[model samples]
Target: MSRESITPNGLNPDRETIQLGKLTVPRLFIGLWQLSSTGWGTTSVTRVRREMRRHVEAGYNAFADHYGTAEQIFGGFRSTLPDPKVVVGATKWCVFAQIDITRSVVQAAINERKEKMAYDRVDLLQFHWQDYSDRQYMDALEYLQEFKNSGDITELGLVNFDAARTDEICTQFPGLIVSNQVQFSLIDTRPLDGMGDVCNKHGIKLLTYGTLCGGFLSEKWLGEPQPDEYGGPMTPSQRKYLDVILGAWGTWPLFQSLLQTLQAIGGRHGHRSISNIATRWILDHDFVGCVLVGSRLGLTEHIDDNDRAYGFRLTPEDNAEIEKVLEKSKGRELVRVLGDCGAEYRRGGGHE
Candidate 1:
């Protein structure tokens, strides 16, 4: 559908918000991962702040994961708002190196996020640990739990954690951990291997990213030829998903077939675009609490098209049509080939 032809209604809180642990958040979150690196280019502080306000006003209240100066920028914008509590920002405490985990050290890290976001308490604090060999992550979580008890953090979550480790943490922590952030999309369906079951068993919600496959699942790429992954115009996210598409999932022709199938199914549902179809497909799963779609902040916005992904349910036939294309590819084999939800990052599989 053309930009002028696409007419989606305003955001509905009833349809969009879900009970994520102790907090109620929009089912669709504005991802700040793009602001983490310059591989996706940069926007001015003023422009970024303006876009942040625009997103919250449109009812996309939840923001997920920040790196670089995103926290400061978001903090600045947040301070100017009349009601900062309306915006929910989730930041990460990623431990890339083994350290002597101390309560003071962990408290200092939490303090930094609190200071950067200009909020006394973080809405959600998502944690990631690179090396599972070290058992100190437990100590870190122990401190985080203490802070949570003290009301310095609202809720706790995980990022890129596999099923076994996730189960371990949840079993150890019980009801304290509420969500697990992982890569879940039509192209990267590794979560289906076991993460979904773990989340269900533990009553944990899966907050997903890369649902749109970095814009590769949109109408713009429906009939186009594959671009040079390392060449002009491909952003960091596109490169990451493209590597999975070409290397593991299937050929470009097969991906095109999947896109064509999505386009046809979308035509049946009020002429919604391919992106909406993909987003709705992921959101259909009962275990999914939210799908984090990357926003370019001031550079680009898809609020209208994204809003359509909600308030509508995909039929069984729509799912059957999608699965037909999926069964023809090697999507199911990703779990074995790439390991679990986060094997690429841990095993040097070159997925960015």
Candidate 2:
């Protein structure tokens, strides 16, 4: 579809909508984690606006960001856009018992982020709880509920909450968690093992990440020559992640076989790229509402590429072969390795 022809429809869902107290975000949300201050990454206001405009044109309306720097970027971009309502934005509140974020501190963060986004009410405010054990979980949740009640946030959500803890929050708070973001890809199917049933019962959606295994799922790594290292001297996060997949999944030979099958599937769907198959493989799973694909803004242009995903199905034979390879591979506690969903931010980070 041409950029001029896209509309705010199911073909490309609206940025936000209300389903009970929960807000249904766009099928694809633009994530700005790279814009975070913790990283040395940089983005100009023009580049940011152009990227956002392209997303809007491609039928994505919702955006995800936790960085204060991202807030300022969106603020500046929003000023340039003709209509910002097409954009529904999400920011986060950290469960600061680990960091000692007081209710006042939480409120201050919300107010400050709202000021930066120039939106009085955030469409969604996802809570990032670092440690689950502290009884302060209740306290942090209550503050979030209050944030929702006070109109500072439109919907309540969680990032990387474990199944058991997420269930407790669901029952105790009644309507607090509309969704939870977790790392789930064909490569990582734990969410299906436990959380899927739980979320199905509660009418909660699972927003997944790492489906492409940081671009390892793409064809570039398929039959191509191997680099000296995963990143090939300063590897992108996605490339390094494919290395993790190699360690856990199998040798390059096994991965290449899986790629062959994925290529066949993509061919059947008229998507010839390794990435098309890799992304479609996960999108076919149950209980996944959306998958967060990363973009480097000015550095990359895969938004249109992502459109190739989800246009076809992987056959039972295909799934069985993929599973066979996975079953043969080394399995480690990825959570322990990478930290829970956004746990890379808490403390120093285990991967480095």
lDDT of each: 0.87, 0.66
Q: What is the C-alpha lDDT profile of model 1 across 1-352, one tens digit per residue?
A: 1111112236564457888778998899999888977778887988987777777767887888777787888788778766677778898888887688999999999999999998999889999988889989988999999999999999999988999999999999999898999999999898888899999999999999999999999999989998898667888889988999999999999999999999998899898899999999999898899999998888889988887787788999999999999999999999999999887898982322
Model 2: residues >4 Å from true position, as ranges? 1-24, 37-43, 96-102, 331-352
C-alpha lDDT of residue 110 in model 1? 94
- The digit string of per-residue lDDT tens for model 2 on 1-352 reads 1223324434523132234245555555677765653232466767876777777677766777765477777766665555666677776766554556469977887887788888777777777666656677678788878888889888877877777777888889876787888877756666765677777778777777676776677777778654556344433555556666665545677667777777776676675577766665656655566666666666566765666564457788767866776776553355556544455455543221
TM-score of each model, in listed order: 0.94, 0.83
Weakest ten-residue segment in model 2 by summed lDDT:
12-21
Q: Best-fitting candidate, measured by TM-score?
A: 1
